[model samples]
Target chain A: MSAITLFGILDVLGTFVFGLSGAMVAIRRQLDIFGILVLAAATGVAGGIVRDLLLGDTPPAVFSTLRPLSAVCAAAVCAFFFGALIDRLKRPVMLFDAIGLGVFAVAGCEKALAHGLAAPGAILLGVITAIGGGMLRDMMATEVPRVLREEVYALAALAGAAIYVIALRLGLTETIAASAGVLLAVALRIASVRFGWQLPRAPGS
Target chain B: MSAITLFGILDVLGTFVFGLSGAMVAIRRQLDIFGILVLAAATGVAGGIVRDLLLGDTPPAVFSTLRPLSAVCAAAVCAFFFGALIDRLKRPVMLFDAIGLGVFAVAGCEKALAHGLAAPGAILLGVITAIGGGMLRDMMATEVPRVLREEVYALAALAGAAIYVIALRLGLTETIAASAGVLLAVALRIASVRFGWQLPRAPGS
Candidate 1:
């Protein structure tokens, strides 16, 4: 598949996972339908919006197209129809969130590289875009972001971005680089969660 | 004074007020000093950051100068010193907020116009820049924005933007037009608050 098509698939998958996580949070908060939709929209598109804005693109994806709109619609539908099933999942919501983080990290890095950003800038954008939507969602929920509090979230994205850049330098094809990056991120995140790996805080105690 | 200088003064004044409001909210939430500073910085400069991004300006204000940093510092000092006093005088907070809204509305419109935006786009930017900081604050606080719910807030900014555009079209000087716009916005906002004026809800409310 073309790089563009691969990017599109990853983007939509990331949006759906992010939207579902946001909806789950909204459900836990007992927000109304409007609130749920708002949270879903914000979570699904906030990272891309920030990425676009920082890249000097205008109007943001949330305002520019129907993809984000459809993502929100799908989130709302899932929340309304499969609410019970979703709530009963054995693994915590963090599994889906990890998938989102992996996909978005790869997608964001790819987009930044396509836009001619240097490797460092692309990596920073990758990490930011992977976690930005969840950060916004947590801010809106008045909760600390998971990346800030729990999980090796941002670190995973950073590692994946680094791998992607290195692969590009080694003359790897786009699909191979992207697959490697996404899998690396997902594996690192899931392994971190399973093994309780976390960043060390300042030693105060 | 030159028109640009006058607008610059207004911009600083608005930043001060926005920072004050953010610090107050942080104090109310019982956040630590670091949290207070974070909120202050976010509230004082996020609107301008978003505006600059939308206008395709590189290295947004947050990265460009120390003025925004100074504004946050000033706010932190004020909040630390006068937290109790501010907590008691809620009316003064509202009045200061009105003034800030007026200044931001005029400044936003003028900036958008300078960027060669059309009247509608300028007006929209005016409203967004005037209230966007507060929206971010409310989102961080996990509350619906007061501008979205309370008396004639965004509407007042819109009115001021429209008046500014009209004055410009009528060949008025920039200073006169901006001053008139600010006054119009402040008066309308204060009047709305005093008389309990509000917009009609969307249909089906």
Candidate 2:
């Protein structure tokens, strides 16, 4: 498959997972349908929107394209219909969220590289792009951002970005590099969650 | 006084009002001190940050200087001590917020014109810069953006931007043009609030 095609698929998958996670959180918070839809749409597209804006793109992808809107609608519909079932399957939700994080990290790194950013900046952008939506979601929910407080979130994105850059240096195929980077992120995130790994809090609180 | 000096004074005043408004909102929401401080800082500097970024200026004003930070601290202190007194005053809070909006709108238009943007784009950006902080604040609070629903909020900014552009076309003095623009915005906003003016809602539910 072409690299662009693969990236597009991964991007849509990431949006789906993000939307689902946001809807789940809204449901847990007992928000109404408007809140659910708002959170879902914001979480599904905010990271990419921020990334694009930083890259000097206009109007933002969420506003300019149908893909993101469709993804949010699909996720919201599924959540509306199977809300109870999804809530009961906590492990599955976490799994999907991890997968979304990984896909977003890889996609962000690629976009940054395409925009001609330096390696370190591209990696940082990748990490930001992967976690930005969740951060916004948490802030809107009046909670500490998951990436700031939870298990290896931004760290996983950073690691994946680094892996993608290293793979490029080794002249690996795009698909192989992308898949490897995403898998590395997912593995690290899942391990951190399962094993209760955490960064130390900043001192002087 | 030089035009730049006038603008500088307006910037300081706008920063103060922005910080005060943010601190007040935070207090009303019953956030802790840290939360209040964060919101104050975010609201005080966020508009300038957005303006700088959109203008393609590097190292946004918040990071480049101490003025914005100091303004935030000062506002936080005021809110911490005099919040009750300020809240007791019926119209002071709204009046101060209107001043901030007016100053920000003028500043945004001036900055956009300086950056060589066309008049229409400058006006649009002026409105964006004026309301960007409030949008961010509302989003963080999980509320519908006031600009999207409130009475003539963004429209006031748009009017100020348009007036500024027209004054420039007529070769008015910089200070006179800017002051007139700000006054127009403030007047429109206050009137809108007093009279309960609102745009027509979209047709149908």
Candidate 3:
């Protein structure tokens, strides 16, 4: 597949999983249907929209195309109908989330580089794209973002972004570099969750 | 003054007050110097950046020019040094915030219309620009956004935007319309705060 096609697939997959996660959160918060759908769309497209905006891409893909909207709608509808079942399958949902995070990080990094951003900007945008959606969801739900308070979620994204940039610098093919970044991010995130790894807190209570 | 110069003054003033508000919040949360500065900049420029992005204006003003950054820095430094005094001057800070809200709402609406957005889109963007920064700040502080939960804050912005749009449609001069919008919003917000006006809560506790 062309690099564009590969990234497109990753983008849709990430949007779907992130939308599902957002819908689940809305359900838990007892929001009405409209709120659920809004949250789902917001969480699914916010990162990509922000990234596109930073790159000066007008009428972001989410606005110019139908696929992302359809993906978000599908996820929201699925979660609305099967929230209980998904709640019982917490491990599966978390695994999907990890995968989504990794894909988004790689796709975002690639896009930033394609837009001629320097390494630092590219890497930062990559991490932001990975974590931005979930951060928005948590913020709307009035909670501290999980990435800021616990786990190594953002660290995992950072590692993936850094790896992608370095691999590209070392002349790796796009596909191979992307795969390496995604795999490492997913593995690191899952490992952190499973092993209860967390960054240190402030010096005192 | 030209409309552009008028809006520029409002934008800078709004950025400064919003940055001050954000810095004060960071101080209250006991964040260190870097954290305070980050919050100040984020709160100051986030709304404008989002507005510019949606309008397809890349390398947002905050990035392309030094005025907004300087305003944010000034506010942050001021708050860092005088947080205690500012804390005691809560009423004055709130007054400044109301002014910021009014100016941002009008400026955002004007920009949206200038970009050829329909009435609904323009009004929505106006409200978003007015409340977006504060919502971000509240979210960063791990609290429900004040606009979502209490007071007549967002309503005031909405009213201002509506007035601006209507006046424009009525062929009012740009200055008159803008002045009317800003004055109404500021008056409404200040009145609401002084009189403890609040939107009704959900049916039950």
Candidate 4:
């Protein structure tokens, strides 16, 4: 498959996983069916929408194409029907979330670079695209975003995007760069969770 | 002044007031200077940015123009320096918030209409623009958005935007439609607060 085709496939996969995560959150919060769908869609597509908006990419892909939207809806419906089963698979969900983060980070960085954003801009947008959805989801749930308080979540995304940009700058192949970025992000995320690593907090409460 | 010019002026004023509200919230949360400024800017321009993005307006006005950015900065700086004084004037702050809501709602609706959005789309965008910033602010502060739980806040914005669209459809002049919308929104918001009016909540907490 072409690079663009691969990216598109992974993006849909990421959307499905993120949508599942959102659906679980809504179920945990006792939200109604409509609320589950809303959260699912928001967590699945919000980040990409923001990234596209920043790049002046009109009518963001999610709005223009059905694949991503379909993925989200399918995931939400699956979770709704299998809430108890999914609830018991917390570790698997986290694994999927980590993979989604990595995929999104690499995808976001590549798109930014394709749009001629400078290195710093590309990296920032990549991180934003990777983390924005979860942030929005947490906000909607009235919680401080996990990116702000969790185990190196945003930092892993930043590292992933930065590595991808650096590898490209150093004349690496696009495939190599993308793979390196995604692998690093997923590994770091999983390691952080396993080891309970955390960024330091400010002094006092 | 032309309708466009008037809308521009009110938009900046709305940005300033919303920025002040954000700054005050940051101060109340004991955030540092950088945090206050970040919240201020987010509260000031996020709504407009979202509206512009959804309408496919590239390089959102806040990024392309200095007026809105400068207004947010000025509000943040003022709030940082005069926090004690501003804190004592909660009623005034709320009044300004209500005015900002009306102005933003009208501006968003006009922009959406200019971009060829239909009535429902325009009204939805308008309400989103009016409530978006504060919703973001509360989210960043880890609070349930006041619009979701407060006294008829989003309803007022919805009513305002709907009125604007209806008036325009009825062949009212732009100025008349905008004025009616703003007046009704501000009046409704203030009255809601004054009378402790609230939308009914879901049962059993």
Please report the candidate that would top DockQ against the real structure.
3
**TM-scores for all predictions:** 0.61, 0.59, 0.61, 0.61
Q: What is the Å distance of residue B170 in model 1 from its true position?
A: 24
- Candidate 2, TM-score vs. the true structure? 0.59
- Candidate 1 or 3, higher DockQ? 3
What lDDT tens digits, residue by residue, belong to model 1 across residues A16-65? 87888887777676555545665776788889878888786765555435
Taking the tens digit of each residue's C-alpha lDDT, what string does model 2 give over A30-85?
A: 55454566578778888987888778764345543578868876887677667888
The list of candidate 1 runs beyond 4 A from truth reads A80-82, A90-95, A194-205, B1-45, B57-131, B136-205
* Inter-residue clash pairs, candidate 2: none
Residue-wise C-alpha lDDT for candidate 1, range B20-108, written one tens digit per residue: 88888888898998888888878888888777776776577678788777877798779978999887888877787888898888777
Ranking by DockQ: 3, 4, 1, 2
lDDT of 3 by residue, B1-205 (tens): 8877977887788899999998887777666554566578778888887888788776455654678878988998888877778878999888888889999998899889999999999999999999888888888888777888768999999999999999999999988899899989999999998999978777987
Residue pairs whose backbone atoms clash in candidate 1? none
Q: Write the per-residue lDDT of candidate 3 for residues A140-161, one digit (tens) a residue.
A: 8877655555477877887898
* Candidate order (TM-score): 1, 3, 4, 2
lDDT of each residue in A70-166, candidate 4, tens digit only: 8888987888788888878988888889888988998898899999999999999999999999988888888778889899899899899999999
Clash tally for model 4: 0
Tell me which of candidates 3 and 4 scores higher on DockQ: 3
- By lDDT, the better pick of 1 and 2 is 2
